[model samples]
Target chain A: LDAEAMAAARERHLTLTKPPGSLGRVEEVGARLAGICGECPPPVPESPAVLVCAGDHGVLARGVSPWPSEVTAAMVANFLSGGAAVNALARTVGGRVSVLDVGVAGDLPDHPLLRSAKVRRGTNDLSRGAAMSREEAARAVLAGAHLAEELVESGGADLLATGDMGIGNTTAAAALISSFTGRPARETTGRGTGIDDATLALKTRVVEEALELHAPDPKDPLGTLAALGGLEHAALSGVVLAGAALGVPVVLDGVVSNSAALVARALAPDAVGYLFAGHRSAEPGASVALEALGLDPLLDLGMRLGEGTGALLAVPVVGGAARVLSEMATFSDAGIEG
Target chain B: LDAEAMAAARERHLTLTKPPGSLGRVEEVGARLAGICGECPPPVPESPAVLVCAGDHGVLARGVSPWPSEVTAAMVANFLSGGAAVNALARTVGGRVSVLDVGVAGDLPDHPLLRSAKVRRGTNDLSRGAAMSREEAARAVLAGAHLAEELVESGGADLLATGDMGIGNTTAAAALISSFTGRPARETTGRGTGIDDATLALKTRVVEEALELHAPDPKDPLGTLAALGGLEHAALSGVVLAGAALGVPVVLDGVVSNSAALVARALAPDAVGYLFAGHRSAEPGASVALEALGLDPLLDLGMRLGEGTGALLAVPVVGGAARVLSEMATFSDAGIEG
Candidate 1:
């Protein structure tokens, strides 16, 4: 991010039509975009693309989530058919959806939008041992970065959004957030897919056990991620890094994506500059991760659904923020007294 | 509002291939629209229109606002020329913008978008006496109602938003909110248009003095409106009533529109059901009025710009909420487990 460009955008906001600081978060997002692009009056993100990385977790063997691992690949098929909530919400904002099968337990059919790049069927249970080897984690991250680069360059996407679809992904997310933020498992764990009180208690204990089993150092971010049991997490974090390197903004969804962002931030501190917390999730883990990342979410609709649904809603908001800088007349242009 | 239709919409949301309650406030809004329209999966507000009521306040003589009254007329010109924040924002959502000159103090050039229906140039200074006669308040409100009706019927607007452009209007809004909500003037008054601490104190004092002089009963809503000095408030309240009568949702801008909503609620309690508090303003009085109206704002972006810009931004959210109900496939249709 360029400090000079951000300062210039802030100064330009005061000169625009509205009163100083009236646009609030929108103004801040505009300034941040300017800094990201190093351009005063940054280009409006006209085309936003969403990447839904689907993986299965072996932690489901621990009964972390009630749904079978098969649901992950099923949802991917639903996404391909444009029938899921993510598809409906993406259409609302003129966004294109692309699904990446990083590691789904079941097979998905071929489709134009589907990028089948499965590293493995699923991860090993994190509670017992490392989910995957460090080398495998690096491969998954590279796959995500390559796809994100393709989306921005060839797909004509100006904005990127991170999405995840794993049956027990939230359980993995809680563990990753607890490890990265150094917060207690109880604070980071939440009810994934509306679990009972007994299940929540069990989930929290599982996260605590995983952290204790592999007290991964936060400084070694990739190792921490590899210690965790989710291929999509590594992949989503890859998109964040790729977006920062490409100077395109990446909007984050709820808990799953936010946890991935923590990993992204750990790997590349500058990646946080290219991120937008699209909406605060109902999940407790999301708030902890967002706070650790120092991000103020643009929308707080109490949505916890992943599949990039929450972040997709914020695409127009980001576009509108840019429009305010580029479209609205200044005080001088309108001939109004300063 | 039909309770049965709302119940059907709520039930439908749970089956829309997402987890229950994951969509948050969008779910609530979709059901509300269903109730208002007596239809399951109510139509998306495809053509939302914003009606900006431009007026002037006689209370400007008492130093309530720093900006000149002429700025109101100039801004009306800005709106007509598509050079204001509201214009840029409305364009972002594919919404049409219409300006009604309910009571600007200066002459405005004829424009196709401008509906000249001035209810006197301004109002009398309210600190000393009534700003407008009871008859004028009713007329201004009627004008607002007529414009709202036209926007919906002829302009093909299914969603309505209230906007204001009077220089010293927030001072008048504070007084009205205090009167209708039964809150003290100091609690209701706020920093309208970024006033200094000294001016805020003076503005609070002005509201208190006006309330004390009239002691307008909340039961007589029109009389209370007459006792207040802003023409836009009456007209904006009229838009609220007309929207309710037309069975279309009305999105409110900020403190000014919120105060007008309070008046609309006082006149007809059912009108509150048709209103959407678009975004909470930075003004303190907005919270007090929203509490009185029992409306949850869709966005809390810390914006105080009151040209319907805040509400206009929420138009897509409202539309998307409806689309979720209308366009999304059910879990049964997608063959997902119930």
Candidate 2:
């Protein structure tokens, strides 16, 4: 990863057979990897792991979503049954999808995809109390990072991506973003699931009230995160830490993930380099969060439906970038009169 | 597939997990395959084959490209070296990339990726005469199809995507699109490798003139394709036919590919349903070609670099769709109170 290593990696990439610079961004990633790993062709992870964190938000009682709190548990049931879109996408990509019960109000039955790691059934409603104690928040973050680290250290995964399942979590994300960036609540809240104008306006007001009450300190990033973080956010931040520590790629999906990454970067600025922004979420906070983190989203489809869908879609792009670096032709080896 | 078989396949898809109608077009593809093959969880190909056809256009002699015809050979060198972006992507996706020399004018050195099956050194300039005689055209199409059939029936490839490597081939595609759609050449021509306004004007005029000379009969798509087809076009048409005969998937890449698919559909309309438009090309004619074939493009990224970059990006999407159908939960299994 040093200058000498990077230059050597670049030389190896330039020696591959193809037109110089024909593979574009893909070649750059390959060369960067070669330099970092100090190998001609670094092995792409044959096994990728996805960590899905589930939680409940106290803000659910505030009527931010049209769907009831029970929908979160219901969808979790769907995920456990291997019926969620994420399951299918993971299977298609030959990656394993595991669900962790970071926190949820309802009791979750034992099932294959479900990983019972609840921090507490749910965080305290931020409008009324500290969402979670700083100690509990740190535990949730460590839990996420630990799971990913276990997979990588066991040689069970080459890379990791974080997925989330929660109701009113968008409110949690908006609150976290507002706290972290010192942005107004209105700037960070949007129609989470096609909410009507009147409901959106009301939701914004509620967020604004919460922001006013919390008045979280931006200088203390983790403190702000813990004060307003959903259990899933903490877990995702952990996934990012694990990826960075293990020197593996971690794809961050949507708003909840973006917030987690913002916190992760606060903890370790170098961690941002290990992350790939899969796509821009329809959530208003996503852009602000990504901007704060300084990352460009790979896809933009006005998609708000989370459950790791956008991240899953961007998997190929990530894979493609790596592939280009590993396989593209250099100017000379291609045997052209260039 | 028979009516009963098709009905059973349809039943299988409707029963899979996630929402009943969430996956849209992917659901239809899954069902149709199930019906056609009469297998609920159809065995996916362990080895997917990508057939990249390389050819040269006589039109390049007219000074239409920023790079010389030699760049085609240079890129073929890249493909053989396993250094092309497509090569890397295919490796990442666990597939093999093969090159077919259908009609390059130059002699290529023996290499592993290159498969020599040239019908001629190159096609005749369409501006002066038909690109290939009808007999030669049929031979080329059948040759590509035979290779595809061999991959599935003998080489054990379950899925195949058609890619092309040829300079000046886009001009040939524009002429074919204009002839097939009865559209103006100006509307169909686009900058290849970001050509300047002056060169683009020349390319457009050349295509218009070629279309007038061919005066293709829309009712007879084969005749139209034969008049304007590059060697790769004829070969790609063959790939589509082979896929249809073998009942496998053939993902189409860009404009030249669109023209070939149009020709393939004319040969057998059922082929259209079997084909998936991988992505929309930045080339102006590609959309028209896609529309004429009545297919939906999965991704659009203003990519005109060709070499099947768009299709390579889409390999994961098709794989993901299949995974969703095979792995996701059915509503009955999730135990939700739906």
Candidate 3:
């Protein structure tokens, strides 16, 4: 972050025609954007793109979610065809949506927006043993970083968003969040897709047992992801790293992205500054992950949908913050004495 | 609220590809839209418009805000010229902005978007006496209602938003909030336009004394406005009523519009059903007013800029809520069994 530009943006905000400190988080967002771009008024991103990563979880066999594993690949098709909730929301915010198949159990047909870069055919059932090899986790992370680079470079995307789709990914997310934050599994686990109490108890036990078995170190983010994370989790963490490396602000969708952020920050501590939490997800683990990163989410609409829907909802707000600082006349410029 | 439509929308949500209730407030917002329009997948607001009402405050004479009274008309002109925060935000959300000069003290030239509807030059100092006559208060309400009607009927606005502008308006808003909700001045009053500790103390005292002096009844909203409200407040309340009457969801800006909603609900309790709190204002009174009306603000960006900027940020979310419900394919239709 540019310290001088941040200071300049803060000074500029106080001079705006509206009351000082009245725009609240909007001012903070604008200042942060300046810090990211190293300028007083950051460029408003015209080509905001959400990279939705779809994968399957072998843990679905444990009844973590009622939906089938094929649902992940099926939803990717829906995203390509523009018929999912994330698609509708991305359209509303004028954000470009693309699907990255990181690790799906089923094969998928190609589309204009689809990027096929599978790390593996999905992780093994983590409740019994390690989810994936450490090498595979590293490869997944690289896949995400490469895709984000392609989007920003070839696609001309100034703003990058991380999105996710998987049936039992939330269970894996809970395990990772608990491992990274040192929170109890009971504290991090939540009802993914409205599970029954019995199923939630089972999911909680699966995560608790898995964490105890894996004992992945938070300092070793790659090792942790290989033990308890879905392949897409590694990829999403890679996206966060890519956004920070490229100096483009990354919008986080929900728990999947939030948990991914924990890994991203661990891998590169300074990447936290480049990340923007889109909304507070209803999933308990998402909140834990956000808190662990010390990041305040922009929206808190209880959205847990992780196809970058929440992040897309916040793109306009992030863009608007910059627009406001650049477009609105300052009190001094407007010749109004403060 | 339409019970059948709401229920149908709720039923449709479970059938959607995402997890049950995972979309959180987005789902609730969609169901609420259905209830508002009496149909599942309510019409998305393609032509959302924000009606900004600008006025001057007699309370400015008491040092309520540091800025000059002329800034009100100046800001109104800025809004008209599309150089203000509200215009930029409205443009971001694809909403139209039009200013209503309900009570600005200075004269202004005509513009294509400006509606001349001045009720009076300004209100009297509320601590000294009534802010305006009962007739003036009535006229202000009618001014807001008439503009909302025109915007929807002729301007093709399916979504209506209430915005406000006035010098020293927060003092009046604080008083109105305190009077209507029976909250104390200390709880409702805040620093308007960045007032110092001394100014906040004085503003609180002014509101406390005025409430004691007038003893405005919450049940008599118009009487309350005459005694303790700014012209923009009364007119904003009128916009709320007009939106409800026309069955158009009303997006409320910050403190001014929030305070006005208290008056609108007092006038017509059913109007609360049509009200959508765009964002929680940094002003203490706005939250107090929202609490009194049982409104959960969609955004809490700490924004207190009153040119309807906060409300404009929420327009897309409101519009997207409907869009998601209408556009997303059902799980069964997408061949994904839940």
Candidate 4:
């Protein structure tokens, strides 16, 4: 955060025509944008992009999710074809969609919107062994960071949003949140993608078993990611870190992104400052992660879809914050009392 | 709510690209909008207008507020000059603003955005007697409803948002909420515009005393309004009722609007269907009023500003809901299966 810019933004807020602090969180959002951009009136994040990180979770074999793992590849194809919820949301919010096949069990064909950045075909089932080797996890993280940098610097995106399309990935997210937040698996686990009571219970058990098998260390983010994190999780964490490094805002989606945020925050505490929880997910672990990060989501529509739809919906609000700071007349400018 | 249009909207939602209910509250908003417009794929609420009802509270004489009653007229001037927070937000959200001087204590000059609809110089001090006569309250409400009708029918505004510019109106709102919900004054009262702890306590006591003196009935909404409601409150309630009668969506601002909504709902239960709680107010009374009306606020920014700022900010989200329904590809069109 840029202290000078933040101070300037706060000063500007007090001078605006409305009562001081009457805009509440909207005012804070503007100030945060200023700090991120190192300018009193930060540039509006007009070019928004939702980066959908596609991966496959090996935990699906443990009956953790009712949907088949092939749904990941299928959803990736849907995203590329602009036939998914994220695509609709992006269109609605005037944002672009980019899909990265970070780790899919099946080979995905090249497409215009798809970026082939596979770290591995899939992770090893955490209940059986570590999800991935530490080197592979680090490579995935680097790939995500690099992609975020490229999108912001070269692709002309001013804001990056996180999205995921991995079946049974919620199990990994729950495990990661449980490990990082020191919460029990049952507390962090939730029904993903409209699972029934039986599947939810099974998913909870799978998360508990995986946590026991991995015994992930919270102190070591890389070790934790290697032990239980999915390839997409590591990549999304990279996106957060890269957004922080590049000083652009990163809007996070549901539980998967929240889990990734926990890992990113652990690796670089300052990264959390650049991140925005777009909306509260219906999943239980998302709240835990957001609480840990001390982020208040912009929306709570009970949305749990992980294709960046929730985050995409929030893009206008983020833009509005910047617009208010940049365009609103000050009390003196409008010849009104403060 | 129109059952035929609502049923059609539900059908349309089931056929949309996303899974049933995946869009969560957003999907509900779309359906409600459809019901409001009496058609499937309801027209986008493109032309939004925020009606800011300006008034003075007679209770200000009781030392319930630190600010002078003249601030109400001054703020009305500021609003007309586009120096208020409401104007900035309206500009940001691409909405028009109209300020109604329903009950300003002082005389006002004419302005482009100002509508002179004075019911009285102001209401009588509520702790001493009824705020206004029963007929005056009804006339104020009719003025609001008539303004809403004219704005939508002739002014080309497709949506109406409620705003208010009244000092010490929060006290009247708290009293109204306490009367309607049967909540204690202390539970429903909050510091308005940065009141000190001592002022907040005094405000609560004033609310309790007024309620005790009037013993207003929730069933007799007009009588209650005459007893405890501000002139602006009566007008806002009229706006809500008019919106319902006209079948146009009305986005409500904060506690003052919520209090009026309670009265509107009491007058016509189905009127609640046309209303949207734009954001959760920082004021304590807002939650009680929303709960009584069974409405969920779209934003929770801890904002206590009452100049339609919160409701104005919500314009885009409401627009997005309609856009998703009308523009997004359905499952069949996108060649995807739910």
Candidate 5:
């Protein structure tokens, strides 16, 4: 983010018609875009690609989510078939969707939209052992970074959105959030896919046991990810870092993506500037993660579905912010006195 | 709202690829759209017109808003000349804009988009007496209804959005909200356009004084409009009613529009079904109005701009909700099992 470009954007905002600061966060969004792109009027993000990272969580063995782990592969197939909510939303916003099988338990069939980047079959049960070795976690993170680079640099995507499709992944996400934000497991855990109260209690207990066993350190994000994070979390974190490194904006989805963002921020604090929270999730951990990251979500539809549908809905809003700066006539340009 | 259409939409939601209630408010929005238009898959709101209602408030004598009263006419000119934030946002969302001179203190130059329906020079000082006579208030309300009818019936607009331009109108809005919601004036009053602590205190006092003077009845909406509502308020209330009578969706702007919505709801409880809150305003009164109306705003950019900009941005989201029903493939249609 360039201070000079931000100052220029603020100056331009003042010259636009209506009262100063009247546009509120919309004006701030434009300024942030300008600073990120180093221009008074940042280029509109024309090409947005949502990366849906699919992985299985070993914690499913403990009955965290009501749905079986096979649902992860099933949902990925839905994404490929363009029959999922994320696909519908992305199509509405003119965004492209790509699925990456980073660590699904079942081998996904070959598909044009599905990218093969499996780090392992699945992470170990966090309640019993480390989710992944540090090297495996780093490898998954690097694969995500590479995918993001390919999408933005070669795939002609100007914006990146994070999505996740893994059954029982919310348990891993809650564990990550609880470890990073120092919140209680019960406070961070939520029923993914609307589970019964007994399952929710079991999920919370599983997360508590994982955190106690791992004692993940906040300062070392990779170590924490290795201890408690799912493969999708590493990949999403990689996507965030890649967006920051490449100077592209990344819109994060619900609780799973937000948990990944915490790791990404710890790895590179500047990465926070490149990220936009797409929506507040119904999950309790999402608020804690967003507050810790100092990002305000653009929408809050009480959505808990984590296929990047919420973030996809926000792409137009992000584009509108830039358009206000790039396309709108200023007071002086229209010969109207302030 | 049509009960049959709403039920059909809910059934359609279940047939979609996600779990029940997973899409949260998005599904609710789709159901509401179907009910409003009386269809299983409601037509996308392609033709949206933002009615920017311009007025003057005699309450400016109380020194509520820091900006001069002339900004109303100046901003109306800005709107006509396509230099205002509302114009920029409407353009971004492919929505048309029309400025209504309901009660500007100064004469505005004639333009193709400007509609001259001035009720009076401005409303009388509420602290002194009724803002307008009961007949005058009724006339203003009728004018708004007529404009809305013209826009939706003949003008070919599928959606109607409300905007307002009046200095010190926030004070009037706070008073109306205080009267209806029974909250303290200080709790509802806020610094309009960023006022200092001294001005905020004075604005709160003005609202308190006006509320005491008017002793407005919650049940009598027209009489309340006569007592404390601005001309734009009456006109906007009329717009809400017209949208309901005609079964068109109406998107509301900030505090002023919210205050008018209160009156509209009081007059016609069914009118609430036709309204959508565009964004949550920074104004305290906005929350009260939205809560009383039971409408959740789509965006919360902390915007205080009252030119329909927030609502305009939300036009796409509204469109997307409908498109999800109209365009997306169902689970059975795509051969996916739910």
Candidate 6:
């Protein structure tokens, strides 16, 4: 929906016992929900689903992250085993979380929540070649879109939050953002996981060199993304697109998801309106990407260790906004002098 | 609860496919909820209540707020009339907003959500005399305590949020912060609304004079609160106390609630643990008060306009944290590689 429709829905916020214009941002969220749902009191998606896409970045082979590429497979195993932070946060939000194995180097165990959509064994090292061929990238994006649509259509969720799990995805994201936003690599590269200054410099050089190799044209957003993006990033971009097409709110976690959003918005400007920045990460590139998107970070707690941590932090605020519109007292009900 | 219990609960966080510590803060919140409820999966309070207490601050008589004291009553009327933002936000949060007429000067109309418990109509102007006598302050506290019990015992509210509506509350809160923290008046004073520098200077003078006149003894928190506190402050202190006694979370707003929390915590340290800082305020004293109380504000967007706006913003976060513990997939269930 457009801002005007959201504004109209907001105009219909239920009168609480307290004076009008008193609750500030809480009130804003309520109004936004009203606008989004085209209802005076929007339906709170009681059954929320957070879909986390897992992949391994070829950039990690360039020695970008301290953690070995094996860590990606190990973490995916943890996600499938339900030992990760996103799993806990998703549980806290009363939503189910599923791991979409879009691209992993190793074979994952058969898990109920694990949906195998492995486009390739893993992305190619971008320093050597494109992360994925255009066909493989399309398959990853379609995988994400199909998953989001399936969840919404099955009445399994009222909201779909896109999360990512990849060791060097930030490196991939930095490269993609540089290509898409036409910014230099220095602005988009940051210390991914407490990397030393030397490693950071090296990482930046890798990104810069990859950007030069890719030379992605902004007009062909998907083409650029396919060449420079990781499986998780491309999948997240697809998720954002699907959420927008379905008119559902999609929360972006850190720079990784944000980089995907930048590409998504380039492809579909209307999709940007549905995106909410969960929080600002300590990652320098996050601020730059978020600013480029003209999005406001909901929380800032010096947190950059991703895995949807920031997005999970924002779940309550989003839920609360929808809840306020659905509940609370009206002025007529609370007959004080207000 | 101690940090160990919180950590223990965190350890019980539903495992995901990733390694431990992957989700970070989202996992922390879930674990925090578990520790608060002393359960592996805490039960989310389904019936939440936001108590918006309206009163006329004695300091308002000294030109602290540009808006007349009558606006407090007018806003209360708007709140009851369903024209206020709080009304809209509360509706979204699925909360019942109750307006307590603890100390409004105007003759409020009868309304369903409005409950009268006026303490001597209003407090005496602090510049002239003590804002309230010890007995009057106790009565206001008692009223708040009673309200909390009523909402929880009979009204079926699972969570309780403290809100307020009174002109010049910031003035009173500033005075309290100055007296309690032994901060200079300049350090504590802030522009309540969009006040000019001249009005702010005058407001600061008023706060200093009131602080000097009261000379509230830190040893006796209630005595200090009685001498300098607004009716709503006293009432809110009582609400925190009652919430603690009832084992419910008390979501706190800006400096006003922060001041009340200080008083309440002085009375019962356990109550301090029950409080969640909804958001930080633009008020200069707010950070001081929050720092003194060791509260980590959930949201901080330079918001100073209080009507329990901060706490209202935080409600969904609380709900979502509870939900995550209750609903998210565990390591075993999701079959990912945590």
| Worst-scoring 10-residue span by lDDT in model 3 chain B | B329-338
What does candidate 3's lDDT look like per residue over B1-338, in tens digits? 78899999999998887888888898888998898888998988899999999899998889988888899988888888787888878877888898899999999899988999999998999999999999999999999999999888895699998899899899999999999899999999998778889999999999999999999888888899999999999999999999999888898999999999999988899999898999999899998999999999999998878889899999889988999899999887788777
Candidate 2 TM-score versus the reference = 0.84
Q: What is the C-alpha lDDT of each candidate?
A: 0.89, 0.76, 0.90, 0.88, 0.88, 0.77
Which pairs of residues collide in model 1?
none
Q: Which residues of candidate 4, in runs, are more than 4 Å off? A: A105-112, A330-338, B11-19, B106-111, B328-337
Prediction 5 global C-alpha lDDT: 0.88
Alpha carbon lDDT at B191, candidate 2: 81
DockQ for each candidate?
A: 0.71, 0.35, 0.79, 0.42, 0.51, 0.25
lDDT of 6 by residue, A46-99 (tens): 766778887888878778878776667776776666656666566655667877
Say which candidate scores most in lDDT.
3
Q: Tens-digit lDDT track for model 6 on B192-226?
A: 76577988999889888887887878778888887
lDDT tens readout by residue for model 4, A98-196: 888889998888887888999999898987899999999999899888888889998569999999889878899999999999999888999887788
Q: Estimate each model's TM-score.
A: 0.98, 0.84, 0.98, 0.92, 0.92, 0.82
lDDT of 2 by residue, A1-338 (tens): 44565566566655654334444444555555554444556556567777888888887777887766676787888877667878777766777887888888899899866777788988888777778988889888888888888788888778687788888888888988888877888899987866789889878887787888878886776677767889999899999988888788788888999989988888888888777787788788999999999877766645565677667777776666656655566666666654
Residue A275's lDDT in candidate 5: 87
Instruction: In model 4, state the lDDT of residue B315.
Output: 74
Ranking by DockQ: 3, 1, 5, 4, 2, 6
lDDT of 5 by residue, A248-291 (tens): 98999999999999999999999999888999999999999999
TM-score of chain B of 3: 0.99
Ranking 3 against 6 by TM-score, winner: 3
What local lDDT score does residue B167 receive in model 5, on the 0 to 100 scale? 87
Candidate 1 — what's its lDDT?
0.89
- Candidate 5, B79: how far from true, in Å? 2.1
Error of 4 at A242 (Å): 1.5
Q: Which candidate has the top score in DockQ?
A: 3
Measured with C-alpha atoms, the lDDT of residue A124 in candidate 5 is 92
